[model samples]
Target: MKKDLVKIIEDALKTLGIEKPTHIEIEIPQNESFGDMATPVAMILAATLKKPPKKIAEELVNAIKDKSVFEKIDIAGPGFINFTFSKKYIYSEIKKLMKDKSKFLREDIGKGKRVQIEFISANPTGPLHLGHGRGAATGAALSNLLEAAGYKVDREYYINDAGKQVRILGLSVFARYQQLLGRDYPFPEEGYRGGYIEEIARVLIKEEGEKYLKRAFDEVSDFFTDYSYKRMLSSIDSDLKDFGIAFDTWQSEKELYKKGDVEKALDDLKNRGLIYEKDGAAWFKSTAFGDDKDRVIIKQDGEYTYFTSDIAYHRQKVEKKYDEIIDIWGADHHGYITRVKAVIEAIGYPKEKLKILLVQMVTLLRGRKPVQMSKRAGKFITLREVIDEVGTDTTKFIFLTRRPDSHLEFDLEAAKAQSSENPVFYVQYANARINSIFAHAREKGIDTDMLYNADLKLLSVHEELRIIRKLLTYPMIFEGAVNAHEPHRITFYLQELSGMFHPYYNKYRVITEKSEQSRARLALCEAIRIVLQDGLEILGISIPEKM
Candidate 1:
């Protein structure tokens, strides 16, 4: 519908022999009394064409004469063109949604673009904490939104399974294992000091049972390193699955080193004169590409930096020929964006094709007080712990209520609430109420098969029309969320729809004495249910049939 309105304005500009702006901005009037859709195209052109906006609006309004599309094209408040769709057109769309909910979904905005979105690639040193949970939910929601918008999206998790971190994890487990075996072994100074390390040691003891007690330290270190990597990675995978997230590919950083992609990336930069050596270190001249200073890709110790592996990973993504590549990282990595983009340009790939979404921190609160520890993880709250506390639906919905880049204070009390105060419950209740209406209709032996025979013109109440109008905005809301890369917008839309619905239901009785009115209203209710389910499904929230 927005597209059709924009096309009409574009056609009007062409008919008048005026060159239009490269992009047109269309808006929904904040005050619904104004119109269904409004645009300031006339006002925008007024400054460019040196004419009064009202006069330009008049010309554009005169150019559009299709009464079927617009009930009225009025020039309102200085220059804005407000288009109120014909009642027939509005009813037609509602019928379409009821007939086939998929028809209301936006079509192919991405045009089958192959997109790779890599997210939640936490190092396999520990369980996924709340920070990682936010990334998982955000990334999964984004992948769903992109696929709905017609992009071929690959959901990937990059495992940082190589380097000092994994070795330290192994040492931590080994130290704990030695302690468990009554050996006085000093733990590594920089080893991981979490209870999880002790847990890994216990599991290893149960399995190996003193077999490694007298082994060489080198052999033990090697065994523990590989063992810890596999065990911790398995835990991370289990946590993600319990939190309702799955990845299409689990790319390993270890594999990058084994396949020599890291060296190849650095060598490519060197051949392009993008790298220089200083202080026995191989450095990339990132400052030339707008970085604050040069960065070391290879250290004096002859080991590749994390930045080098990241460049190689991204270069591998480039080689895969994706039209767009997206990385969802924690907010602390904001400074890393500049150098990563520079490397993309250094590697001769379009920097514009790469998008990095930084997910902010989350603080869990219970009522007015901050809840510090996870009962299950015994340290910071794990993603799985939160899911177990409040099912997957509430976890995902609350995670998305705020923007991914904004700090979220998740309230435990509020999330589990069954009242209207809880946005998740409120939206789900609306869907459940619609279902109840249909279920009641069936119990009353009302033949819903003849719903199409009802006269839609009977839905003349102002509230009924408002509900239909809000339902029609689903596609627009979906497309806007896809374009902005923010799925939080959908949650807001569902809340608004539910807000409009509850009052409308209370004001009007759907199962009326008049059979025609009852059927039309029920059909309208069905349309609302379909849209509610569609939006919730995209957010990975389930819609229950009963409250």
Candidate 2:
């Protein structure tokens, strides 16, 4: 619908001997009395074209060729052209929407561009905490949103298997295993202290018994580290799966080292004169690309810094030919963005092609008081525990209720409520209520499907037309959300659409004594259901047909 309107306006400008701007902004009039859609193109072109704004508006209105698309084009105030869409046009669009949702709702905003989004690549040291859960939910919804907008997206998770964190996890399990076997070995000073460690120890005892009791720690360190992390990673995969997030790629940090990509990337930087030797250590000239100072890529002890592997990983991602690379990191990693983008620039990739989003930490509360400590994790709450307590739908919906970069206070009782306070319940109930309407229509021997052919012009009441007006603006909302890479927009939109429908439903009946009125209203209700379910699906939330 927007595309058609833009074309009409462009053609009108061509007739007036004016070259259109690259983007002619179309807006929905906040005051319904203005029109359905309004554009300030005349106001924008006035000073440059050397014509009065009202005269230009009049000339464009007189020049419009697609007269059937509008009921009337009025010049209000100084030069604003307000367009009220003809009822015939609105009926055609609503009919097309009810006939086929997929072809109607899917916009071509991406135009086949490929995007690589890497997120929630948490260390395999323990269960995923709430912070990780927020990233997971955002990543999953962003992937769905891009796909709906016609982009080919690769959802990825980078495994941090080549770090000290995983080694500590191995030592923790190794120490716990020895103790469970009656050995007197000491635990690592900074080992993880969660109850999950003891569970891993029991599993190792049940499987291997005292097989490693007589071996030196260094001799069997690889086996213990590999077994322990792999176990933790399995649980991670399961938890994410239950949360409705599955990644297309699992790039391993260890694989980057094993394949010599890290060494090759460092050599590339050195060849480009971005690497320098300082005090027997190799330093990267990150400041050359906007960093506050240069950073060390290799220490004097000949060990690679954490940033070294990150450079290799991003270099590899660029080689995959994705048009855009997106990294979703936590707020704690705020300062890390500039340095990472600097390495990408040093490696000859455009820094702007790399987009990084930071998700703020989540604060869990029971009503107003803060709830701390998880019985299972022994330190912080686990994503799995939250899912087990509330539900998969509530956990996901609550995480997405706020912008990922903003602080979110998730109330446990509010999320579990069955009333409108629970957003998930509110949105889900809208679809369920629509189903009941159709069921009631059938019980009265009124076929709702046949209403699709009804004279929808009978939907002339203020409230019915108001719902239609709101329903037709979905594409604009979707385009804005997609271009901004924000999925919380969809959550907020679903709530508003449901909010509109629930009040209207309480006062109106879908199956009335007047056959024509009932038919037109039933068609309106079905369109609302289609759009509500469509937005919910983009957020990856379930649509319940019954409360």
Candidate 3:
């Protein structure tokens, strides 16, 4: 409906002999007094036409004399033109929603293009911490949003199993293994010290038997590291699945090394004159493409750096024929974005084809104080622990309540509290309440069959109009989320929309006073229920039929 109104305004401007602007932006007014829909096109064009904004707005108002759909048009503060559509039009929109609720909100802008979103990609050094959980929730929701927008989307988690971190994890586990066998060994200070390391060591000891303990420490460490890396990856995968995140691909860095892609990537860069030796180390000339300094791809010890494997992984993504690639990384890695884009540019791919989303850190809070997270002290919170304390839905929703680039505070008390204070419960309660209305309507023999046959023109209450107006905003919300590549916007939208419904329910009764008005309002309620269900489903949140 908003798009339709914009077209009408554009045509009205052309018909009035006022040169139509090249573009126009239409938005819902923040203040209800402004009107249902507002536009600043006249103010934007006044400078070019050498006319005052109000005068231009007057001309626009006069040009759009067709009062068929619009009930009123007013020029408010600063030449803002606001339009209030007729209640009849509002009813018509509700009817349209009732007729085509399933397909009303989705758009075909992506046209089935292949897009891969890789996120969290945390090394299997320890259990996933609070930060990894944030990335997982954000990436999973993003993949669902892209699919809703008509794209063929793939959610992927890259396991960093062939890195220094995995080696550290192995040493950490081997240290525990030897200690269990009554041997004294000094663990590396940089090695992982999480309590889970002991569990991994115990498992390895049980599986490999005592014969393996007789081997040299270095040999045992090598065997344990390989074994621990694979086991940790499996555990991470299972935890993510339990958290309602399922990845379509589990790409491994070890697989890249095994397939010789890492060596090939280095050779290609060297042949292209993009790599050179300096200080007995091979460095990539990333500065040629806007990096602050040339980065060493291979160190003096003849070992490949993390950046070497990353370049090969990106090349592998491009080889898979993905039209676009999105990488979700922590905010601490913001500086790496430039270098990664530089590598893509050097590899003959447009910089725009690859996009990096940096997610800010999440701070767990108990009230006013920040919860300390330290892996070395063995006092960090894992993603599994958060889910164990709060269910998956609450955990996922809280993680997505804030923007990916902003600091988030996860309060365990607030999330677990089963009251209106919990945003997830509030939203879910709205869905449940809507479903409850349908059950009551069924008991009263007031189903869709009866409502469809009744006159919908009777839905003229102010609360009914407001609910319909909020329902009409779904398409705009969907479009904004897709354009911004931000799934948290949907979470915020659901909260607001659900808040609107709760008040509407409190003020008016859906199944009371069996008049034509009651039937019409019930129809409106049904439409809202469908939309709420659809929106929550897109975010991977369950809409319970009952609380």
Candidate 4:
């Protein structure tokens, strides 16, 4: 419908011999009384035409040939053209929605572009924390939105299994194991002291029965690292899966090092003259590609840095032929983006093809009180713990209520509440209410499946029209969220839609004896249900029919 109006405006500009702009801005008025849709194209053209905006608006309005679908077109304050939908058009759209809900679904704007998104690739040193949970939820939701917009999207998790962190994890577990055997071993001061590490030690003792206790630290470190890496990664995978996130690929940093991919990446950079020796270390000239300074790819000790592995992983993604790559990292990794992006440019890949989303920190709350967390103290909450305390749906929904770059305060009390204060509850309740309406209609022998025969014109009430208009905005919301890479926009849209629905449901009944009117309204309710279900599914939240 917006497309249709934009075309009409474009035709008016063309007929008037006025050059059309590259893009037209159409907006819905804040106060619906202004109109169903509004445009500022005439004002946008006023400066170029050297004419008063009001005069240009009037001229543009007069040039539009088909005003039958609009009840009226008027130039409002500041030369904005406001359009009100005629009753006939609204009824037609409602009937179309009833016949086929897909009409409201957005088009395939992506046009088969292949996109690879790697997210929540936390090191398998410990269980996933709240920060990892946010990345997982946001990445999963963004992937779904892109798929809905017709992109061939592949989700991935990059494992940092072959790093110093894993070595520390091995040392931590080894210390715990020695303590279990009553042998004194000083744990590294910076070693991981999480309770989960102790659990791993206990399991290893049970399986091997102190067989590795007498082995030298160097000999047992590899075994402990490999054993703990696999177990911790398995735990991370299980938590993510239970949270409704599944990755298409699990790329291992260990595999990259084993295959010499990191060295290959460095050699490629050296060939391009992007690699330089600085202070006995190999550095990449990242500053030439907008980084603040050159970044060291290898230390003086002949060890590859984490950045070296990351660059290689990104190069691998490019070689895989994905049209676009998206990396979701924690806020602490913000400085890494410029250097990684520089690597892409140094490799002659289009910098625009790679995008990074930095997920900010999450502050958990109980009511209004902040939940304290410390990684070193082993007091931080795990993602699995949050999911266990509150169901997966609640966790996912709350995680996305804020933009990826914004600080999120997820209140436990609000998430568990059953009122409108809780968005998941509110939205799900609306869906459940719609289902109950359909059930009542069914019990009363009202055939909801045959709503096609009902007269949709009976839905002329203001609230009904408002809902119909709101439903028409689904595709717009979908497109906006996908293009902006913000799934929280959909959550906001669903919340507003629920705000509209609860009022309508309370004021009017959908199971009246007026069979045709009831059927039309029931069809409308079902349309709302379909849209709610679609939006919730994109956010990876389930719809409970009886919630």
Candidate 5:
């Protein structure tokens, strides 16, 4: 629709003896009364053509005819051209939607490029908290959006299995095991103290018995560290699965280290003069590539830092030949983005190929009161608890309601609400209501097959035209969501689309009088329902047949 409008304007300019401008902006008007779409092309071309804005707009509008798609064009609000489409043209689009509903909503903007999005790489030291859940939902929705835009997407979770954090987790479990056996032990101050550590300790006690616990403190800690890391990772995986997030790959940091990729990446950096020896340690010259300062790759103890393993992991991703790599990290890691991109650039890869998306924290709220979460103090809300309180669909939808970069204040009552106040329920209700139209049609013995073949020209009602206009915007919405790599746009689009449908439903009758026009309206209702279902499916939300 936007393309057709642009071509019409371009043709009008050529006829008016005006050269095409460099660019033009077309956007939906904030005030629906303005028109369906408003363009500032004439205002932009005024300076180039040496004419006043209004003069240019008037001439352009006169040159453009309302022959095909456009019903009329008017210049309003400081030389902005507002476009209103003919009801017949919109009804034709609705027919197109019904004939090919599945493919109508998708755009080929990605051109089948391979993209890998790594997200929710939470450390295996503890269960996933609410923050991790937000990242998981965002990443999953992003992958679905990219695929819907015709890109091959790979979802991944990078596990920090080999780190000081895992060591602390192991020691925490060992201390709990000793306490469970009624032995005196002092747990390290820096170790994990979450209640989940006791669960891991119980599993260790059940599997290996007292003989394993009788070993020296250091030896048992080493054994428990390896066992507990795997156990915690498995538990995290299961929890995410319950939340409807499944990763195509679970790349382990420890596996990368064992494969010697970390050392190899460091050597490659050294060969490229990107690494240097400093203070008996190795550091990468990250500052040269726009980082705040050089980053340490190897410490004085001859152990690689987390940055070293991350460089290797990124290199491995590039070696896999992905057209783009998107890393979704928590907001606290925002400062780490520059260095990671610098490393990718230093490794002979384009910096644009690696995109780091930082997702802000989700602040859980009960009405106006904030719910505090702290991992170190063992005061936090687990993802499982959120999922249990609200179903996975509601949780995912609420998480995706806001942009990832914006902090979200999740209201528990709003999410679990069964009324129209909940955005998720409101959107699902639109689908249910559309299904009700079909049920009414069947009950009245009105055959819908005749409507599919009905002359779409019969659908010229103002309410029906409004629904068709909303449906026509799907492709543009999809393209924007894909280009921005933001799935929250789809959530917003779904809400707005549902709002348009509900009012239309209240104004018009789908099975009134059981005439041919009624059948046509019922067919339109079916098309709307299917498109809503498809949109909800992309967001991983269910369309309840009866809400």
Candidate 6:
């Protein structure tokens, strides 16, 4: 419907020999008396065309070729044009929606473009924290939204397996294992001190049983490192899967070093003159591509920095022929973005081809007070613990209620409430109410499915029309979320749509279907259910028929 109106406006501009603006902004007026849709295209053109906005608006209105569908067209304050559709036209459009909803639901904006997103690739040294869970939720939902918008999206997890942290993890577990075997070995000062370390040590004792116990620590370091990290990575994968997320690929940083990708990437940069030797260390000229300073890729000790492997991994991702790449990282990695983007430009890809989103910190709350529970596993709470306390659905929904870059205060008690204060509960209760209405209609011997094809003209009340108009805004919400790469927008819409529904259901009684008016209103309720189910599913949430 917006496209149809924009076409009419464009035709008028063409007929009057006036240049059209690049974009025509159309919105639903807050004041229902103004019109169904309002635009300021004339005022926009007035600034560029050097004419009075009122005069331009009148000229465009006079030249309009078709006004048959409009009840009236009026120029309001400061050259804003308002359009009110005729009743016949509005009903005809709703009828079209009933018969062909796919046409009204979404457009194929991506046109077969491929997108690759890597997120929540937590270090294998420890358990996943709440921040990682937030990234997982955001990435999964964003992937769904892009796919719904017709983009082929692949999700990935990049493992930071080749790092000092894993070495620390190995030493941490080795000390615990020695202590369990009655040997006195000093633990690393910066080692992981969690109870899970003891668990891993016990597992090793049950398997190896003192076979490698007498060997030097140096001889068994690699075995301990590989075993500990793989165990933690398995735990991370299980938690994510239980939380309703699964990645298409698991990329290993260790593989990059083994395959000589780091050397290949450095050689490519050296040929481009972006690699320079400075003070006995090899430095990357990142400033040539907008980084604030050059960075050292290799130390004087002949060891590669973390940045070297990062560059190689991203280069491999680009070589996969994806149209775009998205990386989600913790907010602490903010400074790394510029250098990584510089690497993209240095490798002949545009900086815009790579996008990064940051996940901020999360604070847990119980009721109105703060939650400060310590697990024996880690100092901070684990994502698994949260999911265990609250159900998976509550945990996921609360995680997505804020933007990726915004700090979130998740209240475990509030999320589990059955009251209106709980956003998920409020929205899902409306879905349950709708289903209950259908069930009642069926009990009265009314064919509930037939209501889907009911005459929408019977829905003439103001509240009914308002609900219909709100329903029409869903596709707009979906498109906006896809463009902004924010899944929280869907949560906001869910609250607003449910707020509209509960009040309407309270004031009106359905299943009085002796009159077709009741059937029409019941059909409107079904339409609301359709949208709620779709929105929740796209966010990887389940719908409850009863709550």
TM-score leader: 4
- Per candidate, the number of residue pairs that clash is 0, 0, 0, 0, 0, 0
Evaluated at residue 179, the lDDT of candidate 6 is 88
Candidate 2 achieves a global lDDT of 0.88
- lDDT for model 6 comes to 0.85
- Tens digits of per-residue lDDT for model 3, 183-261: 7777779878878888988888888766666466676667888888888888988998888888998898999999999
Give TM-scores for every candidate, taking all chains together and pairing residue i with residue i. Answer: 0.95, 0.94, 0.95, 0.97, 0.95, 0.94
Tens digits of per-residue lDDT for model 5 on 339-433?
99998899998899999899997888866688877788677789998889877887888888888899888777767764346778888988988
For model 5, give the 10-residue run with minimal summed lDDT. 413-422
Give the C-alpha lDDT of model 5.
Answer: 0.85
Clashing pairs in 2: none
What C-alpha lDDT, on a 0 to 100 scale, does residue 33 get in candidate 5? Answer: 79
Compose the digit string of candidate 1's lDDT tens values, residues 1-547: 7777788888888888889898888888999999899999889999889999999999888877565778887899989999899899988877876776766666568999999999999988888877888898899999998998899999999988888888888988898898999998987777877788999999999999998885656787878999998999999988887777889999999899999998898789889999888999989999988899999988999898888899999889988999999999999899999999998899887788789999998888888579887523436766777788777777888888889978998877766663345678889999999889888887877667746456888989999999898888888888899999999999999999999999989999888778778888888887788888888888878788898
For model 1 the TM-score comes to 0.95
Model 4 lDDT, residue 175, Cα: 91
Per-residue error (Å), model 1, residue 435: 1.6
Residue 359 Cα positional deviation in candidate 6, in Å, after optimal superposition: 2.6
Clashing residue pairs in candidate 5, if any? none
Across 1-547, the per-residue lDDT of candidate 6 in tens digits comes to 6878889999999998987888888877888888888899999999889999989999989998779989899999999999988777776666565555655666577778999999999999888877788888889999988888889999999999997888889988989999899888887778888878889989999998987675677899999999999988998899998989989999999999999998899999999999999899999999998899999999999888999999999889888989989998888899999999999999999989899989897888788788775533357778898888777777778877888888888876776663345678788888999999888887887766766578778888777787777777777777778889888888888888899998888887876745687788887888788778778977888799997
The CA lDDT at 412 in model 3 is 75
**lDDT scores for all predictions?**
0.86, 0.88, 0.84, 0.88, 0.85, 0.85
What CA RMSD would you report for each candidate?
A: 2.3, 2.3, 2.0, 1.6, 2.1, 2.4
Candidate 3 lands at a TM-score of 0.95
